[model samples]
Target: MSSRRTLIRGGHVLTIDPSIPDLPVGDVLIEGNVIQAVGPNLQVADAEVVDAKGMVVCPGFVDTHRHTWQTQLRTVASDYTLSDYGLNIRLGYSSFYEPQDAFLGNYAGALEALNAGVTTIVDHCHILNSPEHADEALRGLREAGGRAVWCYGLFPNPKHHPFRFDDFDPSWRLDDARRIRKGALASDDGPVYMGLAPAEVEKPAFEAVAEEVRFGREIGAKVISCHVAMGGHSVHVRPSVTTNLGRALLLGPDILLVHGNSLSRHELGMVRDHGAAISATPEIEVQMGMGRPILGAALRAGAKIGLGVDIVSNIGGDMFHPMRSALVEERGADNDVLFKNDQIPRRLEFRCRDVLRVATMGGAEAIGLDSKIGSLTPGKKADVICVRRTSFNTMGAWDPEATLVHYATPNDVDSVWVDGRAIKRNGALLGVQQPSIVEQVWASRERLERQYREINIDQLRSTKGYQRENYGN
Candidate 1:
């Protein structure tokens, strides 16, 4: 019908815009890639209508760091500690997965997110062992029909020895990153953007990582993300005060640090001074025993903050669980107003909606996409998701906002649209068939697992440092 003039009529709209305040009873008029108008209603002329009578329309959720390829390997690494998890699951099998398998897994993962009402995802695809692997992952993410950022990585999320600094070619990596953006990112396509993840910050020599970061900045790759917050096996023992703080000292406005927990007050201030963003994966922090402490530190430092699923391999995948867990855990620890004054401000009292902002607007800022996406501003892209207020998960909720944070599930998402195109409508995908995509992903995982059993994995248990130890565990 009319791509430029789709009317999302009749909903309690949460614009997430302070200027407009709250459009409790509202309608959004989307024209092409941007929102044409947003208000109660002006006219019902030539526009094609998507009835939003019983929906809570808000800006789409933005997942800052997610390993989309791991959708097939879910819970397979459940028993393995971080070290063993990589040794047995990620590198053990993921390294062996065909490019086609990655495509299938990414497809399934993107659709799952769309079905769950996440309109945008930053797929930090680091398993780029080959150029084809990178391209295939990009293809799957784009074709899956949602807004995504293909964050090409220099290192595969290692399950073994350090897939560290010296293993990759920074020159080749730079060219590949450039190629991905020029060939893929430059395309006037739907819902997909391209950037680069610098892999690990700690293991890489300071100069090498700094060069990569500089290269990314030069290419106008607004976001330069690092897996810095989760205190890895190495960080826990020796503890890096220099590199940890030194890295922040080297950062600029476009950079983003993920899981930034260990930074002291001065270091936090350093990050904030740079105008950088922090992505905290609340669920995974608790699971991996990384200590859930981002909320207090980042805010206190005055840094822009966002929430990520980190990787889809755990409860991190869904926005609902992460949002709930972030607020509940933070508030649980704060206890009272006295604690709030110390950590969070007494005025805000560590809000649920503030976390929602981090999940959306703040996330966009982290990725350096605030101007184009994230919020449902008039001129901004119509990247939006509809959570069903009428659903069993949200019914009889006198308070719309609290019920959404406390009760809404992935199933409550009825529709998702990215850049004016509908990806998931009525709980199903648009271009890709969910069942078939998931089947392909599952079949690929089976084949990979079988191949691993035949070729390796028995030796996996023998690998030095491959055990159930954590930073403390």
Candidate 2:
């Protein structure tokens, strides 16, 4: 290990690991990228001491799925439905992206998440319009210095795109995946890993889907993420693609299904039995009329559940919003079912801590990073965060987990560390030029917005673009 050592002391620690009990005043010793010890007190001679008094020390939050390149378009789709998103983002703005735009967006998004104490992210990058786009996105992640899985995308290019694709071959996607797996991400033990986000079932036939899965497996992808059973009615964006793929996809433990808003109990059970996990973006799913959030349903069906902020284009990027949304949505849904039978719910089946677990451990498990992160274990990676409870909204932090999940916001995050490196200290990103990042994102957003207007936004607002593709032949 390097000579660098950090000692975080004098804080209320919530380990989140069952093997260790919560400590009212604990100390954590970190050496290099891994934690050395966690206890009531630790005496270390050659270490930089960080006083954590009046703070809640815990594991950093993990987001299983985020279209991070869409960070610059934050809140642009505040009122957009699933169909509207497909029309505007998938087919419009996404078509105009240059590699630099992908870099700035991904880099800015990574920094944004890090500033908010999110140490790990699964960047579901479907805007890989070119080979250079893939390189730029991975570079952005590495430059931003966060743990991530760059899920290489295979979404088909739209015919109406202004970008020249006469020479673009779909086969290049496979070659790029191979290159990334063998070259850019040869070792799976780094802070960033390689994963695959295959094209939706419609674009890729059953054989293609099988090929993608086999390719991912052959390359030992850390995770194969898919958006399944989401939205009201759209084959291209949110239809029950998983139901169509069924067991033929050969999903294993490496697969992580996102959304699943419309997934049946049978599908959920199949995922659970196959050791696959589900990442539910409760806020976006609820906002887009994608039926109820599947937190309770997935949990009851014995599937591992995780939380994600699906899109910054519509909802906030903080994990708190999704956690809170999941909790209340499930309780409200339960109450509705009880009232239909003329009965009242005696109590909520899920607690605040449950959602917090979904944000931390469940999320880590979703991306297969739980053993190294998600909890402040002695042997785990030092992906830790400290939330100052002195803020007006989080004062009197009698309950650590409750205050974190319900009351705390990104503003309360005082310090964040990933792999023993301080990324955010004293509520600001360390060594990051925020103004430059902002400037780049703003420029990219302006260009994307100007280009998107050419695609006729009014038409997108008036109708669903990809809904017709749902007609199964």
Candidate 3:
């Protein structure tokens, strides 16, 4: 626990908790790592006071899914398709990532999230090429000092050329998972904790998926996340195999399904009834033609929804874009359904505040941390951010919620706190040597590119035609 006490005074606080009313001018008292009080005027002695005038105070954003290790390869897959992503990045580049490279990517990625007011993340670290890679990735998340679930990936890439890929045996995977649980994450409650990213049932042999998921639950992982029902590629284009795997194993609150682009409405209901959550990564899903963002479908099916950046390799690493994209995409979809019968939609089905919920509290619920860090409630962790409402892009904030959804960017973020500790202040991150981290990332990228110089960009692009023909428009 921190000995320092902090008081954030006089700001418009969006608690995100229904029990706590919105405060136009409020004071939040933070003692140690927990918020002690939130009201009009809370006085506490020996506290470092932070003046929050003219700022919009809110719970920090939570990213339910992100390929954080791909951060160093940012934008490298900008124009790549689903199949291209599988072949090139997942299978190709991920083969050469050293433990140091994983450290560079995850460390930088977590810091990027903090800088953007994303206080928590479900980092889908799929490149556990070796035991050392897992160690380095966990270290990176811990060193970055943010709340996260370091999801240990169990997916096998069988297509990486020049390297004979082998699938992780279930016994080996389960044993190592237990080892990490007992060793690195024995305490089970820290800013960074263990999660499982098992191979989805989409892969063949349904038993493998069940085995891994059972192992995750047995190990007491805080969450279990998986890529599901994402179809827009040529190789295997039928849709997720959750239906084939049968319903007996898919039910649970600890499961978080990513993408779900091709899930039928009934499948979504199954997820909802099972108390599972969906992480709808609108930017990547829409761009890669995986399917329309599934936020609308998930909501309609009564499933909890969370927003994610998915792959910084192909998109921006900020929550703003995903929130805005989800809002617009859902609205556009609603309009499409209404206009099909030559009738204009009477009203908007969703609002800016709704998307903001998906970005904040919804994410907390998705990862089972709703009681801890998703709101500005008195007992919640002090994971909060202050967005400058008077900034150039967000000036004249008529509706503060709309301003956050549509206008505010990362640049408008003024201060950020995770677990009552200030990580960013006055628009700059504290205690981080930015230049050294940047240098390390660049060096790692340079080495990978130099070694893998023979990868044919033209050949990779040519697969688009095959995808178009085989998978259709």
Candidate 4:
């Protein structure tokens, strides 16, 4: 028996492990923060019993591409194009945000994510205009009590913002990186892991940006994330620039490239050969009118491909829709086959469960956390979520994999455990008062909107290169 274990019995266990096929009726023993054992009819006297009867016990979902701050400003700039949104909403809204707004927005955002069955999120926060705001934003995320990489990013600019590799030496973004790095290592309570996100390739001093990437190693920044191939934004440089820098700086594992839509074959191969990762956000990409999916190539290139909901402001932020859309879009893109021919019968490309792998294991791999999380194996972190199959939509659903991809929503999630801690229990939040967060978020949004009305940001954007010339988008 495990020393301090919790045994979950009497249900189907889909560990989502490709190595060991699914378990129809099995028992799982979670010892401390690690999954100690898995088998049938496991007996334990002291461990609390979880009656997972008629439920699916799988790994918690990971959203590797989300703008946590923008979630507070949902549907604000929907009328604008990608470029228009960036110049108006992204840059415009960011400039107006004080530290308090960031703190409140991130706090609200993290709660929303946890409630939606996402155990981990790449909080791609690019609104950090100063050191104080960065710390405030990070504090809110850490207090929210979910696994997140507080991805550091620069504030957006309408015109081309050349990053001098030299000037980044002591800027707020780099300082935030240094401070978060120190805090993570020095914190006695626990680590609040932070990652670097220069927003886009064109935002920073390229050389300094490269220096920051190198500095990540020195400062223990485990991950470096960038908005790659997100073609819809007004300020979005050609996807080629993103892939080029990624090739230059993202040398190996732990480098996360978000929105790999325009990634070419050679670039995909480079990413694979370098052992990098690709984060595909189907919901936001499809919503923003980015061309058909590029995940297939990234997946085939042997790079670690993960799933994310992307910008919550543009679309609903639940991980469920992204997973659902991925399943449907991938099938539609390939016609259920990579290349259909008169001779070959749809060569069985990208299955439903395979996409689930991207959301779970692929995400972990992308962020370099696979050993601790991502799977329900012995000696791994007990980051688990149980989806009740008896829910109205999923009643009597026997196929566990199919049920998850098709019917399961965040509300149907029975429980969510992060590092053996039940932050979400019985379909409700345990530690935080979610209602208060919700109220505050709404208040903040209303306040921001009122403030937006005060600032003529649309008039401001008119000064920059807000042209209609699409970059082959």
Candidate 5:
């Protein structure tokens, strides 16, 4: 343990813990990696003091799912649909990434999260082209000094032309994943621990996916995440992903299903019943033609729901976008129903505080880290952020949660801490060589784009894009 103590003083605090009342002007006392006390007029000797006046101090944002390894390819798929992304980034650019490229992407991405007040993330890293790639990705997460669940992706990397089923091999990935579990990520007590992102339920046979889940449990994975029922032709298999999993007795509390846009009410109930969680990346889901977001539906079904950025390749790496999108989209959907019925709305069903909860507490719960890091409660890890409430966009806001949900941007993040260590202060990330990382990321992007440009678009489309018929359930 560490003996360092720091007191963040005089700020509007949103604990997000129902038992702990919100403090209009409060102090958070941190000793070592844990929050020791939280209340008004906290006084202690020899504790370093941080002035949080004019700030909204709260638990740091938790991103339930993000493809951190694609940081260098940010906005490359800005106008692309889900199919376009699958063909280009998933099957094309990912193949050209080297081990060093993975390191640069993950390191830069983790720092980007810290800079944006995201203290914890579920990094769904699927660019593991080689064992060296896995090592470098893990190294990047570790070196960034952030809290993350590095979910080892079990997706196959398309190396050969035609990208046939024959190229889909799981032996190498399984061995490497086990090696990572036994090696660097053996203990869940570390800042960065292990999770598993198995192959899409639609892509592989049910038995294969079940075995992967079994293996994940065997290795003591903290979370088992998978993309399910994304809609817009994303699911080619029949009977639904949740149905298959439920029948197989594979659904459990450890499961986190992303983008359940097309899931039925029964399916949502199944998820809730099994104690599984849902991560809604609303911005990307709507933009990529994955149908409307399932936030409202999941909420009604009483499923544990959280927000995610999904991929920076298409959207920003900030929690604000998803938070606002989930709220407004759900409200809009409800209003549309009222309008069609020729009735006036009584009130908004989803509120700002609700989405804020989804971004922090719900996210932590979704990823199985709530006990350690979600709310501003004593004995929990001191993962906190101070947002500038005095900024032009946020000034004069009556409700701090409303200001954050509607106005606060990543630029307004004034300070951030994870594990009681300040990773960002005074509106800048600490201990990061940002310029060097950016330069290296750009270099990697150039090489990747060059290789990507050399590939024949017609051949790629024929082989990887529209060749879904060849992949059977």
Candidate 6:
């Protein structure tokens, strides 16, 4: 038997690997699922050739955190704050989700990511209303044909019972998580790996949180993610989640903390020393009043940092928004200090390339897949994307990294490949009935909207206030 081969020819290639120099005009040869070679004018026989002229070929973006289950609720919470999201999407809209809704959302969301050149994601799905919901969500991810760490959410759905701030059972969720680990997600080498998204650290008891982390490790989960140090909650809650976890000696490299906007410098250092990473979703963090992004702090503390979309319900799924948002926010913060000191800034400290790295290599490192899919280095998996440099939005690109970070959009993505397979070619997704998926998602959205309006919004708001007072949500 012969191996399959694809030769992507003649493009400006940005291999994120530092050892490999960027190619002004280059070819990436893929044999089977791995990158066979990357250089100029690679000669190969009996291979399918893809013309990459007028394209910017690079490693596909890695989104370290996303609530992909909210695909059907796009723009439903565009004006929502962190509290509003909890009350409306989490408590209100989530009550009407059926198993098919979970499947459709994940499936459509993963496709949305692929369309935007995000080849891999850490799906922080917190919509597990039942074990069947878990199964369907995973099924949707698999069917979408993209790479992901489907972090099985342990957060209890409000639909299952009245929203509880403190008292809730994790025993059943843990059992189901075990079942998922041993069943479909037994192997880490698969396109989709198993991860754990435990309940929010502040809402749950310390002992229970520690137990969840231990159970994730015991089951050999690829990553254990948690929401920590977000917004006003961090200011009100004493002894940050990092401090608590560190005191108990539970912090490890596998832990990926999301939205640490209020994490102090000391806490950031602690995260670095303990080998954990942070995922910053800049747009949502800023818009939802989660405070300024922690990118600047995390960088100063030398913590591993990645960029994420967070939720499509309020923002777009593409990595462009987060990349640009992070870059500008950090630069603006630097300028503010200069202005405060009665001095004009001479140079920008945060570079466009830095945020681009956060979207690709940094994200892969955050999710612990840097060795496999972060770069276009030979021997790594072939997860790559080609953007149309000739497009009006991206024309006359001088610095490839800057062009990508500042100007590129999902529509400019010409092609995408994952595991050497062409998931998107000629600006269209492959092997999926996109129209049918969109129709189903729209139907789900309509049904959810009708059901949500029937719920007592005033009562939900009161409950939100109660939770805020008690659990510091």
Query: What's the TM-score of every candidate structure?
Result: 0.88, 0.93, 0.92, 0.88, 0.96, 0.96
Q: Candidates sorted by lDDT, descending order?
A: 6, 5, 2, 3, 4, 1
Q: In model 2, which range of ten residues has the least summed lDDT?
A: 464-473
- Which of the two, 2 or 6, has more lDDT? 6
lDDT for model 2 = 0.83
lDDT of 6 at 150: 92
What tens digits encode model 6's per-residue C-alpha lDDT throughout 100-203?
99999999999999999999989998888888999999999999889999998887766424545445454688899999999999988968999999877677
Tens digits of per-residue lDDT, candidate 5, 1-473, equal 55999999999999999999999999999999999999998989989999999789999999988999999998799999877888888888998889998998999998888888999989998999899999999999989888999999988767735445355666898899999998999888968989999976677677888898888888888888888787856556677768888888888888889888899999999999998898899998999878899988888889998899998898889888889899999999999999999998898978999899999999998888889988999999999999997778888876899988999998999999999999999998887877888789889999999988887766767763237622452
User: Once all C-alphas are superposed, what RMSD does model 6 give against the true structure?
Assistant: 1.9
Question: In model 2, what is the error at residue 299, expressed in angstroms?
Answer: 1.0
Error of 4 at 29 (Å): 1.7
Clashes of each: 6, 0, 0, 9, 0, 0
Candidate 5 TM-score over all chains jointly? 0.96
Q: Tell me the tens digit of each residue's lDDT in model 2 across 223-329.
A: 88887776454435333456544557586788888888777898888888878888999888888887788889999999887899988888767788888888899
Model 3's number of clashes is 0
- Candidate 4 on 28-60: residue-level lDDT in tens? 888777788777888888888888888888888
RMSD of 3: 3.5
Model 5: runs farther than 4 Å from truth?
160-168, 464-466, 469-473
- Residue lDDT tens for model 3, 287-390: 78878988987887899879999998888788999999999999999998878988898889899989998899999999999889888889888898999887
Model 1 residue runs over 4 Å out of place are 1-3, 156-171, 187-190, 232-249, 336-348, 455-473
Higher-lDDT candidate among 1 and 5? Answer: 5
lDDT of every model, 2 decimals = 0.72, 0.83, 0.82, 0.72, 0.88, 0.88
